[model samples]
Target: MSTESATHLRDESGPFFGEFGGRFMPESLIAALDEISAVYEEAKADPTFAAELAELHRTYTGRPSIITEAPRFGEYAGGARIILKREDLNHTGSHKINNVLGQALLARRLGKTRLIAETGAGQHGVATATAAALFGMSCVVYMGEVDTERQALNVARMRLLGAEVISVTTGTRTLKDALNEAFRDWVANVSDTHYVLGTVAGPHPFPVMVRDFHKIIGEEARAQVLELTGALPDAVVACVGGGSNAIGIFHAFLDDPDVRLYGYEAAGDGVETLRHAATITKGRPGVLHGSRSFMLQDADGQTLDSHSISAGLDYPGVGPEHAWLSSIGRATYLPITDAEAMNAFRILCQTEGIIPAIESAHALAGAIELGRELGPDATILVSLSGRGDKDVETAGRYFGVLDEAALAASALEQNALDANELTDGEAEAGELDHDAALTAAARQALDEASSRVDDLSAATGNGVER
Candidate 1:
């Protein structure tokens, strides 16, 4: 079973994965966390719990997500085959479902009737809401106000799935702020609420448990790739934010000496400009969000703001396990700039017709470079963590698709103004008051275009449509 070797049959002295990962939390919450840890252990031992989870994976969440080789997309990557593990096909359209379902089940076993979580791009929030709806639990998700605006579609998805979305406006109004708000809620509602830490970053048990839940990703991919190619891949790649998806897919290959593991962090503008979220590449070890890990902080040790085109990857700190993995030299961590990531995103869409999440696009960017370096004979597996439906608006704006529509609309308005024989002053300033109407029309055009693009993307299954 995957559970047996997810982190493998190893014994550790405590929750610390090296000098990182510990329960650095309030005294009030320690007992609750310990109870969660104990319950998870007991659940792992119980055949019934395992069987139930396995059934859910088989029927509900779609386990053993397939690996499809991207030959056409590989052409640009120096002819090295680009194989993708399609977690995007999972329930709720992301790898997050795997962890949330497991955690929700545990929450049920712990006699909890409510679930709480934090989201940046809203993938985790949607997954948590899905699980909550399925299990008859009330769900509340904290999202940064900025993220709520950026990923407004996902906010709608969460609400439609029966979850309350709270917008956190403090600080930079991003992931860290949402995280702070969630923790405060958990502290107050610990009695009847299970705080589902969306990533593998929080304190001890969450980092361990979330990774364990998702490790099946790598386990399945490892076997499927070996059977298909008759050898281990040259490299396994994933994007790192709070690092759950990366660790999930990387854990299975940790013992495979011949396979190289790589994690790509988001570089918003450029790391040189200090506007990126390349935590491991340029950050220092510090405590944030209850774990000691690589964090973007100032000289005075206050956490700094992190930026990324992908809201999911715009985080200042990463999971402690990633910090430990980078420290031990087991995996190489690097940066992928926003422009480069969008380039990969465009290429994948045009070449393979696969619209990957902006977060996953960072791994795609890395895969391109790795493929070029490794050449034609090499094989690289990238974790396509989610579908891009939630990102269509952002992508349209980034690629200027929406802008083109706006320009056309503006031209039409100008033509109408000309037909009305309006003076230059009337057109540009006073009488021809079509500014608000044009703006509304542009917004509608962008939304319609984004929806159409999303519909087109849905045609692709695990890979390109044949």
Candidate 2:
């Protein structure tokens, strides 16, 4: 890699990166999308809107999230200097907050009364609910049944934030299905509800708009790295599910030829097997969630199911920009297996005292590989996208760190910790109304899920379509 700058930007003529992104959705959504696009374009140009958003970033979402050098962890990575962009330290404990706060403000600007979103690991759901609570907007989040199970604490957190969580039981019970449900809700309630997309994927304006919201990750990291190292990083590494954080960090460095960008995808067992979500590495261009992108699909063109130990990265499609970036040789994408990611996750926790989201762990694994190949003295900047508290149960099971008794004890300790975090007065006033609504919604969703499961079971046994 040469220490030279190579600059490029996506085409502004339309909502596209090369031939990738565009409005490939139902006509019913066009007006809503156009409205959003127009408003966002105006907001982007207005100093007042920019000032307000900047203030929110500073006081509300914690702007300029610090970059921490991970020397201990770097010891394991071919002695390369590893630095983490600490997005995990932000409010809501993830980079998701950066986008949600912007979108929530936009939603309020559009006079939307309700906010709806879909989540996989529930980071986005929790972030959206937090923003809704802050903005006093009604909120609803759709999550896959399997995801709700894997990320139960986040489901609880979203509920506690006064968001109704709907469990989608259809089709693999994961992010894609939940997204389908969210879009359905958005179309029906387009007049009053704004769909706060969780990532840099989806239709025309969404791919562009969400990426704009998260660009701060790269902008800040770029300035921070330059000040700390007096040079740009050798590689900018981030995990790619829907590719938000990766794109966020990658965008600013795209014009810097010397800064290599690498995106790691979740390879469950391996990409050669049918059980991974390495879309850019193993998939072809296809339409999913209204955007043309790399998608895991069968010969018949049906989308294939994606699997990963990390709920966040289990998706068949990728953000369209990732596909474009790969095609133009601007960025390199690779796969990191579940075992590889888990090992990196444990190493970071033990060595650096940083428990990263399993999704971010994929990037850590990639950085390790890149570090070895690039040799010592190379600096790798990895996006620590979210905190791993949400994955403690999953990680505990993976590492056998928590047995049944220990798990129970841990749960009790967590409950107590959460209780102590709330004041007696505020808890009494908020918990009553919030808990009642949350409990009712939870029960209804569970009952509906059970009924669907029963129906599926009956249909399968009788050889009928459900």
Candidate 3:
């Protein structure tokens, strides 16, 4: 990367990054945003602020998250070494806590008694709620109605953290809608509420402030990787959803000329179709969620709805820094479809005994492709951004694991409809008892499955084995 371009990426002097980010918001919220910017800048200069945040990260948020080698998963990646920066093991099970803790401390400094936030997959909401509880502040989280159903587990976690969750139903009924509502709430309650912006998008200081909070991810991972492999990774990969986690892990390696950065976006179905959240891959320069960035907009400049099985990536616009990164060729952004992401999600679960967030799975999918392209001698570091505990239901439904009993019963019923399934020619010749054969259809199916097992001596032949 050119020094000029890298400066453009790492520059924090203003709201805009190259041609991407700027303060675009309603007149009513400008003053509040400016206040946040001022407070954040002051906090940035204070050593006491850094010390306090580091202490909180160490004691509460689980700082210096570990990295683990995914050797088993590496086999699927063409034997490339897959080292995972395990942000999933953090307290709230994601990198979101890093920013939330910082912002909550800022909120306290600003004399705010409440925190207003928006969430997509609910990790940010859970994190913000946790911070609110820690600081004795009231919390309210705006979430899309669709997300509330899909990520119900995180919803429960937020409520248990003593936060009120409002389900926004307007617009696309996803992350963007929730953000719109959160902004409106901030406009109304700016005096006593701090809108803990979740990702590296939104207006002005939000993108900068959020990224600063998360830079520790890359800093620690960089040193850890150096110690583990005695070299910087050949490539660092992460999922880009509004660009927080991606920028978090990608920041430290920006100056390393040989270290490549790859960010995977959510391709709900396929990038060829409209059902995708590949902002940097499919979008053009535009404004959404208070920042001018790469956005999925129609020719008329209307922001289009984004789709993704991973709720966190379901946004039409991405952070301005990502747009800048893509424009300057400092980073590569690609689309990973739902099927591809879920396949990697399951692969990590079964192979490495680690279940990653669906959002992070996109990064894993991209890393697999890069591993094949870069060869086995290469090293790839992936940001396993969050655990899959909240995604158990979604994964179960996606893999059909939850419907196993129903699937088996349906297969048996469908098999019974085919008389030829019972015998070769006796049934056709009317030499067999149809009633008996039909009655034994389910058992026959079970027996067929059991016969394939080498240790069937302990099998009950009813889809069960001793």
Candidate 4:
């Protein structure tokens, strides 16, 4: 085996990739990350941890997630044979549970009683809550108020799973703000609480720890794809938010110099529009959330609000290792627009009967481009990172696929009926008969119209007839 494969197959001892993976945190949290890292190192070596996690993988998270060949989707991509690692099919509906379960287990080993985390689109929050519930630990999720509104159902799901949901109302009230709140909470309650950082970003041990937890994705994909095709894929593609899912699959193929790795970032409106979250493509070197990496900041060193149809990819900074890899040209970073992602989202749902998360659709979009380039002979593997349940409403509204005109017509119809009722008021005045009935009927009609609008909104790109 090559050195990289040997390092990954064995227990992750000393950081394998580079200096990008280490423990750099506040002095207060340093000892905790150190302890956690040490325990994780030992756990990897111990057959018990391996067996336990493997059991959970088979029984709970459904390990060996299928690698699906998308023949129809591939047809548009230059006839390149495209395959997808269906991480979207994992328990809790995403690859996030992989890392959370490992961390929760580590928390048990460390005797931590409480679990805390920050969420962007609520996928990580839901995954963390699921692990906390399974482990019977107190779980607190900090979500930006804006994200809370956008992903309200996921917030409710987390609460129903026995997690305390805190809506952060700080700067911009988004993922970064929620992360700031989580860091503050960690600093304050470091003794009893373990901060479950979601991605392969943050500081030091986090990138390494989370990457180790998720490396199973690549491990399985590498073996499965080789078995199915008798050769490694030409390229591996994944979306980069905090870079966990991308790193998860990319790490295993690092030794395969013939295998090209591509990471897709969300280009909210467009890169030049100054409204995108394509950090690796357009950002400058800076430190934002504890590590030095490419960050979207203004001339004054102030971080800007990142835009994306998918809330998960709307981050101002990318993972440090991704930054290092980009610098060394080990991987290529590409940006996908909201329109292209939405189109891919519709295509996946229509073609494969799968509705991919908007974030994951970016990778699908990249696959479309790669398919065109590689042609029919090559094979590409894309990580379907998460599900699309959280983005249906947003996608509906963005594409003008919702029945706004029908809703407006219904509203106008109700208003006309109300006007006729007022003009034909022929009942008792003091007893408030006709006017009251008219007002109640108008409100009811308007509510029904609004309901139609909501229904239309929910139906967008769902492959449902209008």
Candidate 5:
């Protein structure tokens, strides 16, 4: 089933999705990529390969991810039925496990003993490391230096799973840099290492293969939605980075012309500003990471630095198929600013008691906007792509929990200093009790923040919760 339904609409054999996808890689890696392509093509046709992979999904990766209707959350979004595809519950805590497991299987088929990958939010890295450990393969993950700091929890998880995590510190020191480093590493070590690209980008069969691996997400969701609602959903939504997860969930609905597909890209501050990764929304087609796709490039076609609060969406280029979809107007791509995404992030947590990754929050933000546009009768299915456990630190910092902690810590240190009679060299003068005074500063700040929240909640009973 899902395989037949997955590719029911278009051709997957060609190297191009319209005019956007093609092998724009180095000569040194063409043969390696071609080898991978051929192997993947063969495996795709082989029933045994499909059977094995399906078994893995069924037993290990957890296939048929449930879709839960968020009635409480939907009330905030113009009363539109908001159903969430719970990919966040998958075994590596994201839809990333779907592609990683399949790639690892293919790598085994190709006799590769190592898995090389690049990650942005580190979910992909964690998934790759997980599959590597499961299949007894060595794993190396490259991540941007900036991402490593924000996603320290995932970095620790990767190392604990036996992956050697390399922090890439080039250019913007984000996803693009890490991808560049991973490609370089793959080119040098193609003999025994399989570059498990985490998304539906890169060269030929990868976009096809990775999407095929994840199409089960849409396939299951489609049937589940129909079973639950007794009709098709009015729309489907997902956040797009290199575009694997979006493609996975979007593919099954492509044949249903009436079902709208919406992809949300990261707009760090605003699209008007230079700091955004809304590739499909504010980009032109250009080659990046071995394929021609919508890229944030300059007038002279040079790649531009992209920024987003979500490391996963901080890429300058998008998957080629997404370029095709946008070009054809089959799907709509929108920019979700950091503020919008964070607000939605807080809403989903307060409303549904589910913390989502910042990347997925973009889609949540879009859903609210789209739901209002479509009104109460429509049903929108949003992909909760990943859990927020790996993102808790970043979110906490964003919400000022870290600032509060630092203030309290500093206040306590000041108290310790005052007790030691070393209060800024005013010990003998005794001008003030530095401990209580400093602690009060922190307390005052905390009180002010609490008061603000309380004031808003009092004004509108539902304001603080959502």
Candidate 6:
């Protein structure tokens, strides 16, 4: 069978393939998952639930994000036509809100009083917090200590929205660590708290639930593309962090046999350096973060810390759905390096006036490569997963504005810089003066971020008060 038929052959009901997506949680949480599953099943069948969600989408979360044609960026891809699903325009500034809102609604239906989630880049944290605030539910977010520090602004954003942020200092102090903390919290508080997973990974219900929530991305884009150009796209492209956005768009195109699907994973420094997060492209089957999938591990089967310029994709294992998709030959997984993603980041900024989250840049980079192969007439759709506001400092450092010499002298130097080593005048003249530039860059970043957020809010009619 062709890839399309194979994907279509599988129904949305039961019979999850190969035990890849069965509930693997502690016995305590099984009842909650069962309750959630039942509620979801009812919601799926009931027109009232569907209408309410549709109303929220139309008024709260923004359905039907725009499909923008990137002509200039497409030129580098051998003149192939390239379009972007502007999920970055979604409320909370990423594709994350789509899943969060849906799950939050599900939580409300389940009669849960609190929402809990784990985050790395803080995008999901912010989205979850936003939903909780909207629904008037209590919220708690667990983030790795390192991520909390690196993404302090997001931490503050969540706090401002009345969500509690706990910094997990265990393990590698990243997404996995935060996830461990969240899982522990879930096991302890499963009855009253709903764990809103950010991606289509995780155990049983999550892979299916998150995917169903995100499927709107592809559903809306499919119709939009057809309306805009009168035909199906030649291919769909998305960055695969936990494979949420990729699966979202890909699910819609699964039955469209001619429409190719490509998912790009992060290759932090360089895959050749062995210091990367290209899980699907450079990993083995192993268990990590509550799911069995492609994982970066050592000879002893111990999980390895992953590196990526994009914190969102800095994970050692990918979503189980992605693993199954790859094994079934339904989708192709590729790796995009930090350098390539950064380059694409700048290209989108310069050419299209769009600054995508570093994570989304990976897909943009892949689009460039695939476009070249497809040439000018072919149409490819890429998901602009989020905005880049949360990554200015990292991007500046990667782009050399915050290089070693500058870091040694800047305000960010702080404890690392010796005050006596440089005179006041010298310190003032050197990296410290870079503050104005940093501030300007930060403002621009935030402005871009808010614009995307507003676009999503407007589209979804979510009416984000922020």
Estimate, for each residue in 142-220, the C-alpha lDDT of model 3 and write its tens digit: 9999999999889999999999999999998899999999999998999999999999999898888999999899999
C-alpha lDDT of residue 383 in model 2: 97
Cα-based lDDT at residue 2, candidate 3: 58
lDDT of each: 0.89, 0.89, 0.89, 0.85, 0.89, 0.83
Query: Whose TM-score is higher: candidate 4's or candidate 6's?
Result: 4
User: Taking the tens digit of each residue's C-alpha lDDT, what string does model 5 give over 267-287?
Assistant: 999999999999988998888
In model 3, how large is the Cα lDDT of residue 398? 66
What is the per-residue lDDT of model 1 for residues 4-39, given as tens digits with 9 covering 90 to 100?
543542223237777888888999889999999999
lDDT of 1 at 211: 90
For each candidate in turn, give its C-alpha RMSD to the true structure in angstroms.
7.6, 10.3, 10.8, 6.3, 6.2, 9.7
Tell me the deviation in Å of residue 86 in model 4: 0.7
Model 4, 136-246: lDDT tens per residue? 999999999999998988999999999999999989898999999999999999899999999987876787888888999999999999999999999999999889999
Candidate 4 ranges with C-alpha deviation above 4 Å: 1-24, 400-466
Q: Which scores greater on TM-score, model 5 or model 6?
A: 5
lDDT of 2: 0.89
Q: What clash count goes with each model?
A: 0, 1, 0, 4, 0, 10
Candidates 4 and 5 compared: the better one by lDDT is 5
Q: Tens digits of per-residue lDDT for model 2 on 123-155?
A: 999999999999999999999999999999999
In TM-score terms, candidate 1 sits at: 0.86
> Where does model 1 exceed 4 Å of error?
1-14, 403-466
Tens digit of per-residue lDDT, candidate 6, span 1-466: 4565446733443325443445556777778778888899888988987788788878877776788999987877788888899998887899999889889889998889899999989999999999999999999999988888778889999999999999998989999888888889999988789999888777777888888889999999999999998999999999988889999999888778799999999998888887789998999877676567788999998989998878899888888878877887879999999988988888887789888999999999999889888889999999999999888777755554434334333433453244434534675666555655565555565565555544544554322111
Clashing pairs in 5: none
Q: Where does model 2 exceed 4 Å of error?
A: 1-7, 10-14, 408-466
Q: Where does candidate 6 have its weakest 10-residue lDDT segment?
A: 457-466
